[model samples]
Target: MSEDVFAALEESQQQSPESVLERLIETLTAQKNYHRLFDALLMQQKHAMGLEVLQPTTFDNVPDERKKEFEEAYIEAARKVGNLFLDEKMYSDAWLYFQTIQEPERVSEALSKINPRTVPEDKVEGLIQVCAYEGANPEKGFEIMLQSNGICNTITVFDQMNAQLKPESRKKIAQLLVDQLYTDLVQSLQYHVQQKMPIAPPADNLRELIAGRDWMFEGGSYHIDVSHLNSVVRFARLLSEDDPHLAKVIELCEYGSRLDQQFQYPGESPFEDFYPAHLHFFKALVGEENDRNLAIGYFEKKLEMEPDEDDKQMIAYVLIDLLTRLKMNERAIELAETYLSQFEDPNTFSFTSLCRQTNHLDVLQKVARGKGDLVTFAGALLDAQNKPQPQES
Candidate 1:
């Protein structure tokens, strides 16, 4: 077969380019060499366009009139090769082709179906990259990392995630971590509780399991890794209020709060009482009526008592963001008007944006005038002037 292919290839040099391409395609297709077939198809398109086929060139070099045709050929060839790779479960290779055509969804769907546990060791890293970092199936990728590499490595990966990751993907991964840590803590705590008490405690809820169990923390004993607890509870802040995992996360914070003083590491600013602060924040986010008010009062006190300007600003921003998330925009606007007036950097936290959200351009103008920021003051004046007047009956 090799000799015949070589003979045909040698013979094709004497034939027309079109005939040569046809023979190449037929031969490569017969051998199931789709990768080479992709190159051959691209070569054919380049030949038709009267461009040099020996070297690679971007679509930018293609004439305006021919660009669409060239792109169509590229997309069709990519889809053919990409799907062939996908059908063979060659996900990483498939991603290469599909990504060029901006069709990650096809690869993402295929990746989602894969059981990471069953994947070969040699292939695991490649699949992880395609799934996790490539934005194909981050949740599945995170699961693979957690299952295969264990919690420590998974935490490292989460910590090292760059800003390029979508907030939604980050949230999903965070929720997974929360669920895993919560389950681990519950199981460990249940075992400890069973050793001491004859009656088995509630199996699922962390809060119920740990309730009135002061003896559980005797001699600085902890059910789960305190560091893991701290990391996961912090990650839980990224979760949406509506996420079912928020309740579990809040429960985790409750567990953390009971840890000995040495384990209760102080956090920055408003979360100085790390577990307690986060517990209240998560409670408020969970939208229990009493807890919501308590959480608000908790942060408000932090803002009031904090002497450091920077720390106070951070607390105010946290409170303002929480209020906004809870749809207490009036409260958010009031806090912004009070505490955020001095913060001029929009990139940090946009006082202007909050003003816009509340439709209080007058406040923006006032704040702008106070700061002597002519650009913002003038813009606010123009915006107010352009408002559609209310019609008098």
Candidate 2:
């Protein structure tokens, strides 16, 4: 809101998206309206500059009494906007807005306010065609589109189906919809568990794997490794895109930007770990950049709120991640030790204190010492520490 913040945003824009977005968001706090402001700015940014900002429409920003009004406005705007696009259709195009919206309120309005009979014949035909799209797989389409990792275009296809069905085909289409749902679910779940890039090890038996991890290893890990946290975060975010499924996305950000980086590079510079795999997701959800302080606060909130052990570890890692990025080794070491104390798993993530936390070299005293699962990290730290203090040449 201030000219100084505006200048800061302008300056940051040249450097990186996250920076500019973050600084600009600080100004938005002054605006009384939340979702509307985001929608308006994002609409302008996307249309004017071709920047795709996913404007969040969460109810948290709206006042209690005004929530219903905001909801109506949002749905009405979305429908109107969607219809505006449909108006450009030369022929029949189904009014597919009803199907794409999953919010109970929007769904009810769409059902009550819009009628299939009122839609154009060609539009009805288009709806049927979209329903039949191989991707939509009509039978399973609606559920898939609503799931955590559900796709949007697929939902649109289903909406189109809903928009154009005749009384005769309605029952048939409904049955087909039920049948394909199971099929699509199977496929989507498989896709959710599989990875291709630098592809992860086969999730040969994910059900068993996730289930087998006792209290210490279950929950937060989701059976993923430290290296894959970013990819998971990115994919999770793209799947949910901030609509309550947002929590998972944020978790990934905390893990990668704060936690995993801490474990991988003990006592290292923290700035190196700022690119939470889901920056794009955050950009889309909040439409504002969170500063270091705010980001740190989010991490703290995560740690406090998370009840699961693995998730808690992930949160701990995030603290380290932030510390490492900020080049706060002493703080990072303290946090890391605290984290290690929680789960005593030397094989997975173990690091000795690098600073002068104590004058004695006893930090590595707990090293597992090469009885098979002893990590090589102990050796690396030992060698680095034992190297005699340098003498003037």
Candidate 3:
């Protein structure tokens, strides 16, 4: 039957190949031989147009009108063959044709039709890839992999897909994964709250999920987001508290602080949104039994960089007190003198007294003498002397 259609093409050189192809198509249509019809039409169409048959790359050279006409017909034929292959339980063959047509839905449907338990481990990865590829319903792919293999398998595929995607696509996929992680975290926390239990850290993949994403993409540069830093800090703190892993807690806090310090929170100094995270991290750093020096170092760094008036004073006070208690007198005096020179009085009635109490007399005397203002320093000293220290309980 196929031979008869090609036989007529020899009848005339004057007749266009399109004309001959059209007649062959009519014959195949009349006989309901759609399978051979698609091939004959494709070959004649490509041959007349000087394109390589079955070479999808040559599709670009074809005019839009012609491309659309054949794309529709070819996709339909591929879908028919794909569905037939699926019906015959030839999932791999069905997947190939369905994927070639770039119909994600049908490809997903074909994969879903297979008995997952029977799918070979090696082939399952490919099926997972097909599902997760761009426009290939990654969320559905994730579900399928999770159901068939496990969370570990799904995560492995996701990690691979994330690595393969370009920046823009990777960013998009990263956000999707982040949203998914956030959703899961929230749901789990909500369940814990309802059960009157403490909220626990999420699966370890939460870290992997966020590992590749830059918190901010501005002007083609990647920047960390303080909120993401805070989330990590909180995660670390929660785990540390639950398990009392001081070393890991310190590591997380230090990392969070470093990231926080590196990123200006997109607005004013001493970002209001970041204050809680920063405060919590500081507290966690100090809260550990043996890392007091780490806490002092963090506070000193904060004082060195802090620009906000109140924040600087607050940090100076903490740093000065820590230094004094640790008997690091040289650094303590240096910090006090610096603070006295640049620090704006925080408008609290007792801020001078607080400074006087936290700092040693020698440091205050040196600052006062250096400023050539004995009178003001004298008043501060008098106030400090007059204010009785709190009695020990």
Candidate 4:
């Protein structure tokens, strides 16, 4: 068969996952078709392959005649196509071929064959998809994709895995993605820095600081919870290149550090209030704030660069929260008035936090309807915000 004919036939097979699995099985069994099937299957996924079986017994209980027909079509397609090759570098082409195979169930059955084996994901991309979506062994799949040389393919797999993760798992995987990419990304950024791109730190202590544990480093059984958030933030930075939406997330959660203050003064800076993981993340992103102005400047640059709407508001809101804490009530009020037409209700965490900090009643009274979290908590934060200097009060 010509490539075009095989291509057309492959398209037809892809529409039915069950049929594809059966065909693959039949091809695997047949002497003449075996080679051809491997060719096509190998070309189908640059990593791993598996059938996404919705019903295992469907094939088992099929009438012999129907099973025979399905098997024959698959086997025939395999024989006619002859030996084809799938290269890891040629993932997109392989993706199209796999996309043409029909029957996810059939694909899943084929996958059942390989589940127990620790196979390299680069050899079977479809399995990664199945395992990720169909509840197969994802940890193994994640490792292979990360190690693959093909950057684009890795990104594709990452996106697929990211979509299916739970919230807690998302934070974990996002961290994993960041950890995996940070070195390369930092190297890339380092190059940009040498070439005069605006950058804060030269990838020096960053990698070394992150690399401490893989070997002899041990924190002992008395685990420090603060360090965990710091680790997550480091990973978040690495994961951000592909997920720009995090700029908004960072605005909301970036200030969420858990580091315990060491000194009696500086009266618990906002920077130290969240988590050490966040501090590491912020340091990587904005560098050390030698002074308060530098910290505010960092915030300014962030606000200017943020593309997401929610992110923009959060940035302004967090700043307002900071200013209110700093006794810069006038500035906090100014921002609330400016952003009122934009931030709106419901997403008023930042706004309320600001009003609470500033004690500017006129700015806060209009937003009084939300209650509890709105009034009580905000009022408490307001009172705390009103505390006199550490020595004076």
Candidate 5:
């Protein structure tokens, strides 16, 4: 039947191109062959434009008079074919068309509906690549990877994730890790405590689990994988202060601090003490009254003692960020004015943004004038002018 239609299409093409396209579309649509229909539509558009070949790179050479028409036709065909592929549960094939048309949200939405358990073993990795690494549905992708490939692989992938992944996406993955590790640690602790005592630990909280169980740490014993613990604690920094998992993360830090010194490795400045520093940092982030003061004093001392100018800058930013997070905007502005104002690049920390957020453009103006940065000085003046002024009572 297809051969007969193709034979007639060939004959019709010689007589009339429109007749050939109409016949081809009718036949492919009857057969539910939307993939081929997509190609056929593009072929018809290119034929109309007198182009012998149709490639994305060659689109620039398309006649200016008809470029919009050609692009619109291409987009329409891509959407039609991509939707058909999605309806057929052909996600990999659907991604090709939707991606070409810069419509990842369509593919992402479809991929999100898939249950990880029902995914074929052979197709798991490809789906993971599209959903997680390619930015389609990162949370779902990470979930699928964790459930299918296990925590080790998920952690490796999470660590390898570049800066292009949005902070919210990273935070979601971090929350998953914290939950997973928290569960594992609690189970392990419960079992161990059960072995020694007649009953299990009453509290599921990590801090409560090991409150007086020094014997649990005997001979350098640990409940969870120490490496996983370290990685998740580091990743948990990306989590927001209000995240419920933050409490578990701090508990993990406390557990890490109890480990033998051999397990305690150093980290970058401000976190050089590793788990202990993170415990204090996370505690301070959650507004723990004593830890807040301790964190402030600790970072202040580190900033004062650092000898290297570069290291000092890094430490100063950390202190400033901590101050800002604590809602001590005045102190943050002071630190920014003192340590960061001289630096023009705001990639790491924007002094201008800090000043603006605190409604202290006057401080920015002062810094800009001191540095002889006319652009910023002028910008501050303009922003100050735009701010709403109070009327006389």
Candidate 6:
């Protein structure tokens, strides 16, 4: 069997790590064992500089002192190889080597020393790979690329990395990209509002960004941030004020509402779990358009979506009132009867006024009679008989 060269050397003398590394260099060179020779060179360099060389030992099995010693040794060895690479003007190689060090600040240092342009086009991926290693921030590495290469070059390199990265690494890259996009969106919207510029362009830009990737909805945490969503709602409202007919406002509200829907809160409470911004937007939209059908349609859709009992009741009332005003008495009475039937005490909903306005006395009397509350039914019948019908205009 081939002997383990470094292990044998360690038993022969109590040489400092550096001296042992120097001896290994001499022996590996004499043997011309290039494969093991390169490994020895990197290992010895780490040893000589007191950098940790990662070994396959279990941390639980190792004593604290030994763990500390190995860590220190690993860092030293890594520094030696990195410095050696630097001296040879191999900045890219040096950066890749230093990335193996567990510390982030040192990796950043190695990245700083690299000349971005000198990195061969083929090596761009390798550079990005090292940067995306666990502790290193991918954005900081991209910044280095930006400085060395232009934005066009940096983006091209980023696309390549994104296509061939690990899932975790890809997620990190995605997060950094989304964060920059969010910042730009907020800044652009703010500028548009401050200068009182036409909001359509910024609003369109925001919609595009939101649709650009799903990661934007993450909002830098586990759940979506309501504040971030509210900002978009506020921007849409502002745009609506400037151009009441702006179709983009409706689109923004829809998109924001969809985003808000994906968030889950801990409780069953409607106020805590659901967002009301979209409702407000829809209400404002209905008022501006003054289209009776649109108002009716919006309220009906909202009534379908509202899960809470109280919210449903409120939306149903609005819908029934709007229907009465439009003189769609049959439809209004139908909706009122459907909703009022859900309760034991049907009179509690108090549909008498709605019946009187819409001339839905017969339907109300039927409902009142079903509950064995004939007194209320009798009054509705009497009112219907006494009231004068409308005259044709």
lDDT of each: 0.85, 0.43, 0.53, 0.45, 0.84, 0.54
Candidate 2: tens digits of C-alpha lDDT, residues 293-367: 566666666667777766677777757645554555666666666554334433334454332333223434443
Q: How many clashes in each structure?
A: 0, 19, 0, 31, 0, 15
Please give the TM-score that candidate 3 achieves against the real structure. 0.30
Tens-digit lDDT string for candidate 6 (1-393)? 246765667854585656676777678666744334456765654444455644422234345666776566546655666666656545455565566674346555656566655777766666655554333446556755554554445545656565445444444433433343345445654454445444434443455544544554545322224444443333232222234333444444444554635443222222232334344434544454455556566667777888877777766765665566456678778888877544433323467767766677888789889889878889988998998979999
TM-score, per-candidate, Cα-based: 0.87, 0.24, 0.30, 0.30, 0.87, 0.31
Regions more than 4 Å wrong, model 4:
1-117, 120-123, 134-140, 157-164, 182-281, 284-293, 301-393
lDDT order of candidates, top first: 1, 5, 6, 3, 4, 2
Pick by TM-score: 2 or 4, better one: 4
Regions of candidate 2 where Cα sits further than 4 Å from its true position? 1-290, 341-362, 366-385, 390-393
Candidate 1 on 254-306: residue-level lDDT in tens?
A: 88888898998888788889999998898898767898999999999989889
Alpha-carbon deviation at 307 in model 6, angstroms: 12
* CA error at residue 176 for candidate 6, angstroms: 36
Candidate 5: tens digits of C-alpha lDDT, residues 316-391: 8878877887889988888888888866554456788888888999999998898799999999999999999999
For residue 27, what is the lDDT in candidate 6? 80
Each prediction's RMSD over C-alphas, in Å, is: 3.2, 25.5, 21.7, 18.0, 3.1, 21.7
- Between candidates 2 and 5, the one scoring higher on lDDT is 5
TM-score of 5: 0.87
